[model samples]
Target: MLHALINGLGLGLLLAIAVGPIIFSIIKISLGYGKKAGYAFITGVCLCDALLILLGNVAAEVMRSALEYKNLIGIIGGCLFIIMGIYSFFFGKKPDFEKSRDIQVDYRKRDMAKFTLQGFFINLFNPGPLLFWLTTCTTYSFLNTNERILLFSTTLAVVFLTDFLKVNLAQKIKRWLTPPNLAKLHKATALILTLCGVIIASSVILKNFISW
Candidate 1:
C-alpha cells in the first residue's frame, strides 16, 4: 500500500506538470473567473478520469483492443485540438473581470456550470488522456485488484490536489494575465494544437507508406 501510494503520488505529479490544452484552460479560468471556476473545471476533469479508470477495470480486454487503433483516436483528437486552437486564437473572448464583478452574484452558478462542462468535454475528447489511462492500467496489470484500485484512487486524489494548487497559483498571478498576454497565449496554444495534429497525421501516413 505504501508503494502504491508513493507511485500514485509520482503519477499525480507527472500529470500536474504535463503540458496540454487542459492546463492552459485551467489557468485561464483561474485567472479570469476565480478559484471556484477553476475548481469546477478540475472537478469535471477528475470525473472523467474516474470514469475512464472504471471502464478500464471493467472492460480491460475491450480497452486493450481499442489501443490497437490508437492512430484513429489520435486523428480524431488531433482534429478536435486543432479546431479548438483555431477558435481560441480567433474567437476567444477575454474574460471581462470588471463586468464579472458587476454581475458576479447573479451569474456565478451559471458560469461555474458552464466552465465545468467545458472542462469535461475538453478532457473527454482528448485522446491523450484516454491513451494515458489505457497505457497505465495495462502496464500495472500485474498488481492485484485491490492494489490497482488503491493506486488509481490515490493518484486521482493527488492530481486534484495538485490542480487546486495550480489554480491558486494562477489566481495569484492573475494581474499579469492582461489581454495582450492572453492573446499571445492563445496563439501559442493554437500553434501547438496544429503542430500536434500534423504530427499525428504524419505518423499515420508514414506508418502506412514508409517501409524503412
Candidate 2:
C-alpha cells in the first residue's frame, strides 16, 4: 500500500507538471471564463484520464508489449514537449482581456457542459496521456487488483489537487496579467517543458543502458 501510494504520488506529480495543452487550456479558461469554467474543463480532463487508465488496465498485455518501445516513445514525447515549450516561449502572446469581460453573465450551464466536452476531447486526442497510462499500467502490473486501484486512485487525487491549485492560482493572477508578467509566465512554462523533456528522455536512456 505504501509503495503504491509513493509510486502513485510520483506519477501524479509528473502528470500534473507535464507541459501539455491541457495545463495551458486550464489556465486560459480560468483567465477567460473564470473558475467555474476551469473547474468544468478539468473535470472532463480527469474523467478522460480515468477512462484511459481503465482501458490501459484492461489491455495490459498489449500495453506491456508496447513497453518494449517505451524508450523511443518517451524520447519522442519529451522532444515534442520541448519543441512546444520553445515555441510558446518565443511566440506566446499576452492575454487579451477584451474577450474575457462579463464572464459571469455569459457563462451558463450549457457553456459549462460545452467546456467539459471540450476538455474531454482535448485530453482524449492527446496521445501523451494514453501512452503515459499504458506505461504506468504495464510497469505496475505486479500489483494486485486492489493495490492497483489504490495506486491509481492516489494518482488521480494528486492530479486533481494540482489542477485545482492551478485554477486558483490562475484566477488570483488575473489582475497582474501585464505584458511583462505574461512574458515571464510563458518563459517559465517553456523552461518547465524543456526540463520535463530532458528528464523523460534521460530516464529512458538510463533505463536502456544502465541495466536498472
Candidate 3:
C-alpha cells in the first residue's frame, strides 16, 4: 500500500505537470468564471479518467497485449499532440474576461452542467488520457488488483487536488492574465506540447530503427 501510494503520487504529479488542452481549458475557465466552473470542468475530466481506468482494469490482459505495439501508439499519440498544439497556438480564441465575468454574475445550475459536459467531451475526445491510462496499467501489471486500485485511487485524488489548487491560484491571479499574457501562455503551452510530441516520436524511432 505504501508503495502504491508513492507510485500513484508520482504518476499524479507527472500528469499535473503535463500541460495540455485540458489544463489550458481549466485555467481559462477558472480565470473567467471562477473556481466553481473550474471544478466542474475538472470533475468531468476526472470522471472520464475514472472510466478509462475501469476499462483498463477490466481488460487488463488485452491492454497488456496491446503494449507490444507501443511504438505505434506513441507515434499516434505524438501526432495528436502536435496537431492539438498547432491548433491551440494558431487558432485558440482569447478568453473575454469581461464577457465571462458578466456570465458568472448570473451563473446557474444549468451553466455548471454545461461546463461539466464541455469538460467531459473535451477529455473524452482526446486520445491522450486513454493512452496514458493504458500505458500506466500495462507498466504496473506486476501489482495485484487491490494494489492497482489503491494506486489508481491515490493518483486520481492527487490529480484532482492539484488541479483544484491550480484553479484557485489562477482565480487569485486572474487580473494579471491579460489578453496578451494569456496569448503568450497559450503559445508557450503549444510549444511545450509540440516538443513533447516530437520527443516521443523521436525516441520510438531511435529505439526501433537506430543502431545506437
Candidate 4:
C-alpha cells in the first residue's frame, strides 16, 4: 500500500510537469476567466482522467482493440485542437482580469458548464493520457484490487491538487499582466495549441502512409 502510494505520487508529479494542451488550457482559462472557471475546467479534466483509468483497468482488451482506430482518434483530436487554437487565437474573449478582482462578475453557470465540457473533451481526445493510463494499468497489473484502487485514487488526487495549484499560480500571475502582454500571451498559447494539433494529426497520417 505504501509502495503503491509512492508510485502514484511519482506518476502524478510526472504528469503534472508534462507540457501539453491540458496544462496550457488550464492556465489560459485561469488567467482569462477566473479561479472558479479554472476549477470547473479542472473538474472536467479530472473526471476524464478517472474515466480513462476505469476503462483502462476494467476493459484492457477492449482498449487494445480500440487502439486499432488510433489514427482516426488522432485525426479527430488534432482537428479539435486546431479548431480550438483558431478560435482562441482570433475570437477569444479577453476579460479584464485586473478589474475582475474588484468586481463581482456574474459568471454564468452555463459558461461554466461549457468550459467543463470543453475540458472533458479536450482531455478525452488527447492520445497521450489514454495511452498512458492503458500502459500504466498493464504494467501495474500485479497489484491486488485494493492496491490498484488506492494507487489510482492517490494519483487522481495528486493530479487535482497540482492542477489546483496551477490555477492559483496563474491567477496570481494575471495581476502583473498588462493588456498588451495578455494579448501576446493569448496569441502565443493559441499558436502552440495549433502546432500541437497539427503535429498529432500529421504524425498519425504520416505513419499510416509510411506503412502502406
Residue 16's lDDT in candidate 2: 75
What tens-digit string does per-residue lDDT give for candidate 4 at 34-113? Answer: 78999998999999999999888885444345765656765775777677678768986653444433312345756788
In the range 1-212, model 1's lDDT, one tens digit per residue, is 78667767766865765545666677777767778988998999999889887776665554346766655654554565556556655875644333333212223656677777777878889876886676556545445677888899988998899888879888554565566765566567556655555655566567767765
Single out the weakest 10-residue window by summed lDDT for candidate 3: 97-106
Q: Show where candidate 4 strays beyond 4 Å.
A: 60-110, 171-212
The number of clashing residue pairs in model 3 is 0
Q: Which candidate leads the pack in lDDT?
A: 4
Compose the digit string of candidate 2's lDDT tens values, residues 1-212: 89788868866876775555676688788877888989998999999999999998886655446765666665775676567567666775544544433223356756688888877888999876886676567656546688899999999999999998989898564556655765566577667756756776687688779896
Identify the candidate with maximal TM-score.
2
Sequence-dependent TM-score of model 2: 0.63
Q: Number of clashes in model 4?
A: 0
Ranking of models by lDDT = 4, 2, 3, 1
lDDT value, candidate 2, whole model: 0.73
lDDT of each: 0.68, 0.73, 0.73, 0.74
Judge candidate 3 against the unseen true structure and give its global Cα lDDT, from 0 to 1. 0.73
lDDT pick, better of 3 and 4: 4
* Every model's TM-score: 0.59, 0.63, 0.61, 0.59
